[model samples]
Target: MAALISTTDTEAQSSGDPSSKRGGWITFPFLMATLLGLSITSFGWVMNLIVFLIEEYNIKNIAAAQISNIVNGCFSMLPVVTAILADSFFGNIPVISASAFISFLGIFLLTLITSFDYLRPKPCETGSILCQSPSKLQLGILYAALALVTTGTAGTRVTLASAGANQYEKPKDKGSFFNWYFLTVNTGAIISATAIVYTQDNASWKLGFGICAAANLISFFVFISGKRYYKHDKPMKSPFTSLVRVVVAATVKRKAVISSKEEDYHHNELIEEAMPSKSFRFLNRAALKVEGDLKLSGDDSFNNIWRLCSVQEVEDFKAVLRLIPLWLAIMLVSTPIVVQASMMILQGLVTDRGLGPHFKVPAGSLQVITIISACIVIIINNWLVYPMYQKLTNKPLTPLQKVGIGQVFTILSMAISAVVESKRLKTVGNEHPMSVLWLFPPLVIVGIGEAFQLPANTELFYGEFPESLRNTATSLTSVVIGISFYLSTALIDVIQRTTAWLPDDINHGRVDNVYWVLVIGGVLNLGYFLVCCWLYKYRNLKNDDQEQDP
Candidate 1:
């Protein structure tokens, strides 16, 4: 019955009528996503670079960095709300469109504030037109704009991709489309980060930011034009519906998980060895009872509830609950990768050797390498690595396994930076330009990690999620990335303030201690990645168990 339902849902979507614009609607949303990425992420990199130019600000450690954390954290937490809305009222099209517009507005406002300062002038002021310092008004605008953009990225970007994935015909095609989708996304981002960074570096900030805004608007236009082709799945509307859906879907996933576990139990795999702590287990056990009670007592007008649900429902509930911690762990590893554009990149600017005399590299541009490298690596991995691995091993890696591979590289990427830091420190005060080329190796490593993890993450999210909770799962994955962004910024703040040995010169952008700070983050990321690998290796959720029949 479950298999039937899953197949039916897939067919309902892919069985495109010849009279309808099957492919047109999908391209529209995807184009919107691309535009959103160009504009919003462009601003994101700009804001991050703004904080890193501490020399321009003159104040020591302006807690300005913390703003990234606050905004990112808030965005991460708010997705639950957006997810609910997407399920109920907004649907994918509305949510994506609305979020893009909101984010665009936020960025426009941010640009206005950044260009006009009341208190400080070098960074904000333009000759005669005085820019205000961090006034209450300007600060408010900054954060408010940040919140809007974050919402746009989290709410719209994540949801739209998941929604678009549904537009494809077959399950296998969906899997392939997502892979291509993610690849194109990074490719677009790579162009934005690098090209836009170059513009911001060589051209005026306004021009760079303006270009991004234009791109965003263009993206929205494309998405709107071909929306007719999409399969319009009615999103769950009521909060109660959303809540019930999450519960019901999670329960079914749990049953699949248990089935997978039973299979693993027979095979003597490392499934049992992969448990979190005793506390997590106890919580899971406790939650089982709560779910069982809820399933027994809650409104049950559906036929499935009337039949076999009494027994299988509880186990399915348990399985979905079981995966959250694991998700958290995997996200921990990816967070650093996500933050490379902001925290780590900034750290490189002040800490790594400058590109030339008084000519440090721009923080915003550093993100370019990661994106570019990711694109290059993705193409290679799909065409070369996966094929080579399959030929060599007779069995290719799965998504989680691929994610684990990415994590390993994420760790190594940081280690590469740490070594570079050691090099920069030795050459300090010499006035000789440190090769920005040194930054590329670490950046490339990060790219390798991203190519592996991001595609894997999207697949893991959709595959593991129950059909009803697909949007929620996508939202959850974005939140995980969001949380990591906040954590990375927070850590940067702590290190910048707490380090007793940071020379006054470097603190003010002379010594470039940013590299060292990132090195530490890399080490921390590595440790967490190891744990993610272990947990992912242990997780057991089988296709036959979770999948419903069409």
Candidate 2:
């Protein structure tokens, strides 16, 4: 009875509880969302910590970077599976619940293994006749732990986070929902990146895992707790049954077209408003077909163009298919963001910072730098960028524009990191210690880029994709990111081997060359982004299959 408050375990029942109205203090819905956001953010820190510990065992930096890919790759691939089920079979709530449970198990196991400190350097005696260690089993446990969290993360955070946000009332409360949603998420990031980073380094691994687990469990409870506040956001019926039938009936025009024009009046207005791009023309023509001669009221107009698209017409499919290229573009941009989890960590360790006891720079500390950067960026966006954008352009930045801007920052940040890396290299043998402060500047730049990019990207991806396909779109973005991480691993290997870039002594544990890898990556990404900007220009609002462009 307690858990049954929501229709399904995942969705909060939409019953008009007294708690539904937003007033004085934080509403239950927003509070729950905040907690969930924090949980997921902390989980990210947990994953980072786990990978770092595994890396610590090996003397080789490149191997550690490659090992980090295991989580990224699996999350990217596995989510597609969960998202498909979520969109088609299970629905978002159940997928979220199931993911949490999976994550719970993964973290518990990881905590148990870490409690034993299995990965810590094993005691070795001088010629003590081959000391045997039982750490391999623990290592396997560690990987499995990561997989569970990643799998849960894919569903709960990746697939359902925005979906969770969307279940609220829209058009009116939309901005508020996003406000709390984005703010809560960044809040979580700020905490996890700082507290989690600090605790993991200063405290034992168990403490770190336990903190994360506690946070995650709190998130699980909060989501379930507010079962009374959330509106039920069920998936549309399966394509095999209801959706397919709806498509067929519409295509055959047998179900009666009715006065759907009024229902779609907003769409027409949008078409009229679009720029004269090919996509706009395409949208206009297709819309014109749908609305053959706006003169004929309803049924007559429909019958006139009734046969235009059969149930499986090529053009209909193509209209739906057009969404793919844009989706791919958004997904590709997300790659660098997700890949940063491991890559940034490696960069922090190796970069030579001039200030030390001056600052006490630690190897795994660079991961925190991004967090600091993210906070700075997050602040500027909410306080400065979004407002300035409104004033400067008169028209607010579109989601696409926001993403484009972020890409530009991503290019610049990468370039700066590369330059810093090059600078650090020049000082390698010199008396100057690479001041950790130098890392801060590049990190802040990347953070600003992330601020500009991620939230807007998230909104655009989910909003632009048809409601039924949101989960799949989210998963696809993740997949693009996963591929990027794998590429990061490959780049690390190549850089480590081919070049005499890293100092040999610090080479294994230190990612001295990691910055170089980021430098090259930034150059390539910048070039790719330029091409995207050019191609993206031709797309018009009318041509888009969905998205009621402003």
**Residue-level error in angstroms, candidate 1, position 495:** 3.5
C-alpha TM-scores of all predictions: 0.71, 0.71
Error of 2 at 81 (Å): 3.7
Q: Mind sharing the TM-score for model 2?
A: 0.71
TM-score top scorer: 1
lDDT of 1 at 22: 46
What tens digits encode model 2's per-residue C-alpha lDDT throughout 1-550? 6345334433322444534332222334545553554454444444466345543453344465576675667766677777667767677667777787777777777677667655445544566534344367656776777777777776665545555555655555655665665556656665666566566766766787777777777767766665454444556654333234334434554333333232331232222232212332222222223444234665653333322322223222333445556555555555555545555555556555335344444445565566667667777787887899779866566766776777777767666666765666566666655666776776777777777776676666566554445556555656666776676666556766876554333423334345445546555665665454445432224444323321
- Backbone collision tally, model 1: 34
Shift in Å, residue 298, candidate 1? 18
lDDT of 1: 0.57
